[model samples]
Target: MTETVLAEVLAELAELDDPKARAVNERHGDDHGVNLGKLRAVAKRLKTQQDLAVQLWQTDDTAARLLALLVCRPRAYDRGDLDLMLRQARAPKVHDWLVNYVVKKSPHAEELRRAWFADPDPVVASAGWALTTERVAKKAAGLDLVGLLDVIEAGMATAPDRLQWAMNHCLAQIGIEHPEHRTRAIAIGERLGVLRDYPTQPGCTSPFAPIWITEMVARQGAAVGRANASPGR
Candidate 1:
């Protein structure tokens, strides 16, 4: 049954191939040659099909791996399985999607984060930081915010590119969500000068932590104001 499902999935992907889209993806370092829109559509149809997802992932096609990230049951795999998958993730796009979509949603995310953070493998370490950034942005109730800030301040300068991006995001989330640390986060951003002068396209917010934090904080304040100004309030 898994083989049959894998065959069907591959057939669908083959039919959905787009040369133009594939070209764009290749330009952006995605050598998959498969259309992402079609992959998402396939994932929606195959949701929660863990056996098929594993089979597709074993095929090692980029689109199939992305589908695996979407459809695989997070609870079915433990840290060992995730570590193996991360080790096999050679493509940047595949590694990123696995981190965001698979690892972040897993029940063992925090456990994996602790282990992966210290991993010498850059991909594993990047995934750890990415998961931490998500937790900081969303549910930071029990996290040691000060310790986290200290780690980011100490390591972000020498971190690899992928890990550095997520670390910067974590710093911004601290400033945006934790008012007590906002001043310190901004100070760290200023000291590091990360993306401080990086050119941004028209209308896009800068990724520089200070600017990112300022915009997020203002946006949050405006949201609160709107909620308070509402008639029901």
Candidate 2:
């Protein structure tokens, strides 16, 4: 029964593939060609199927794993299982979705964050930083903002592209959300000059840390102002 279900899902994914989509995804380091909307539609139809999700993930097909992530219970996997799956997920989209959709909700997220943040693999380390960024924004109770900035300043320039992007994002989050660290974060970004020249589509915010921080802070301030101005408190 499982084999048949897996085969049917594979057939569905194969049918969704498009050469044009593959070409576009290739530029972003994702090998799968299935339209994300179509894949999600399939996942919606499948709903929660941890068994089927595991089977799909085991196939090591990018599209299949994406669908698996969409349908699986995020808390079902143990720490080791999530770690192994993350290591196997080399494609950018798969890695991003797994971290954002599954690991973020997992009970083992902080444990994995501690382990993966220091992992030698740049890609895995990037996931660690990604988790740390979430903490920086939401649950920054004891995190050393200065220490994080220190690491980002020292290594981000030379880190691999993906890891550097993660660190850069953390920096921007700190500056955007914490008034005390905003000046130092902007300074680090200005001095490093990483992603300063990154190409951004028209009307999209630049990923360059200083600009991102400023734009987000401005938007936040605007939001606060609007709330304060709202009638009848």
For all predictions, the C-alpha RMSD in Å is: 1.9, 0.7
- Report the error of model 1 at residue 31, Å: 1.5
Q: Residues 119-165, candidate 2, lDDT per residue (tens digit)? A: 99999999999999999999999999999999999999999999999
lDDT, model 1, position 188: 100
Worst 10 residues of 1 by lDDT: 29-38
- The 0-to-1 C-alpha lDDT of every candidate, in the order given, reads 0.85, 0.96
Worst 10 residues of 2 by lDDT: 38-47
Off by over 4 Å in 1: none
The estimated TM-scores of all candidates read 0.91, 0.99
